[model samples]
Target: MKVRAITGFFFVIVMLGSVLLGPYVFSVFYLILTSFCLFEFYKLVREGGFKPSRESGLINGFLIFLFFAAQCYFPAWKFIFFLPVCLSAVYIQELYKKTPAPFSNLGFTFLGILLAVVPFLFFHAMAFMNGSENFNSHIPLGFLVMLWSNDTGAYLAGRAFGRTKLFERHSPKKTWEGFFGGVIISAVAGLIFSHYYTELTWQQWVTVAVLISCFGTLGDLVESMFKRSINVKDSGGILPGHGGLLDRFDGLLLAAPIVYAYLYFISN
Candidate 1:
């Protein structure tokens, strides 16, 4: 247990520090994250009684990821229009092949992109999400701090006084007590960083906090549902105590887009 704690702490510092560095560093983080997440997601699909072409899935998934990367690195709003094109390409390519009953090769391919590629884009989007003036100089770093506050509060409170379940059916590990604790912690963090993001009102900042805590949990549950459906303990072995890439970012996947949307719509 002590060893796990030490290892987990070190891992968090390195990962968070790299992520906090900047957009260029963040892009590299997302690429590696998307790649490993795709690998773990494919593992889940195979477990669910569908055998997809590993080479095809990885290739197609990475290509879709490239589209997202382009949108971020090059600033292409047309990339949003490209989603259907990419989805269709993946579907048609997979459906053409032979497979067994309930064998929707296209379905697995589509799911992979949705789960793996889509969320991966948000991290990049958040980094580069601002217009010229409204851009928070500390955007990526501030965003991650909000998320970490959520997790930290949830973990400490949950350990101290978590008993009732949050969503017992989907995720046995979550507790309602911890959920509320995370929300409170995130709100506090949002308030703290409210100055850095001068674009938002206190109310808007508070809303962001609530969304981060609540939707963050939703994202966690979504991944938990995926893991449960496939009967796996962790998504991968990339992070020490965090389990996998998916495990670490499960909450942030939904939270990132939301944080982006808040800035995009309200402030911009």
Candidate 2:
């Protein structure tokens, strides 16, 4: 556990430093993480004796991640249109092949894709905005920082002060103390980013803080539900202490699009 902790700390720091540099840096990392996660998801599905089009999943997942990556560099909304089509096609094929219950497994899989893809879109959108204008380009980095901060606070507080369970049935180790700690800590991080990093006002920061606190928690829970449903402990073994790339990115998956949406609305 100690070794895992130490490794996780260093790995996180390096990833943060690299990701914040610009699109090239973050894009490379995002593609790699998504690939690992998609592979893990595919593996889990196959192990369940349900075969999803592995080719489509990999191609679709990679295309989705790369599209967001390019969204940072380009402004084409056309690619975004293909996401649902591609994913739905994957689900439809699966349904026709072995034919699961009406919209049961297929719906589950499609929903999973939405949950996974949209935030990544936001992450990329931030980069594009950053390049196009300097008014709030830092929002992308700020959003990611808060995500890391959320996890850090939750883990530390949960270990130090946690007593009461938050959702004992869904997740055994999660405590209410950790939940509040993550909220407070992420809120603070959001405030600091808005105050010092971006030109956004206090009101904006407060809004961002709330979104991060709420949506980020939802993202984490979503991943947990997937794991629990599949009777798996970790999403993958890619990361040591983190369990998998998906495990580490569970919150960011949701938070990224949310923060982007807030910024987009504000920008417009």
- Tell me the alpha-carbon RMSD of every candidate: 3.0, 3.2
In candidate 2, what are the lDDT values of residues 173-221, reduced to their tens digit? Answer: 8888998898888888877776686557867876777688678877888
Q: For every model shown, what is its TM-score relative to the native structure?
A: 0.84, 0.82
Where's the lowest-lDDT run of ten residues in candidate 1? 128-137
Clashes, model 2: 0
Runs of candidate 2 with Cα error greater than 4 angstroms are 75-109, 130-137
Query: Against the hidden true structure, what lDDT does model 1 obtain?
Result: 0.73
lDDT of candidates 1 onward, in order: 0.73, 0.72
CA deviation > 4 Å runs, candidate 1: 72-96, 132-137, 196-199
Task: Find the candidate with the highest lDDT and give its number.
Answer: 1
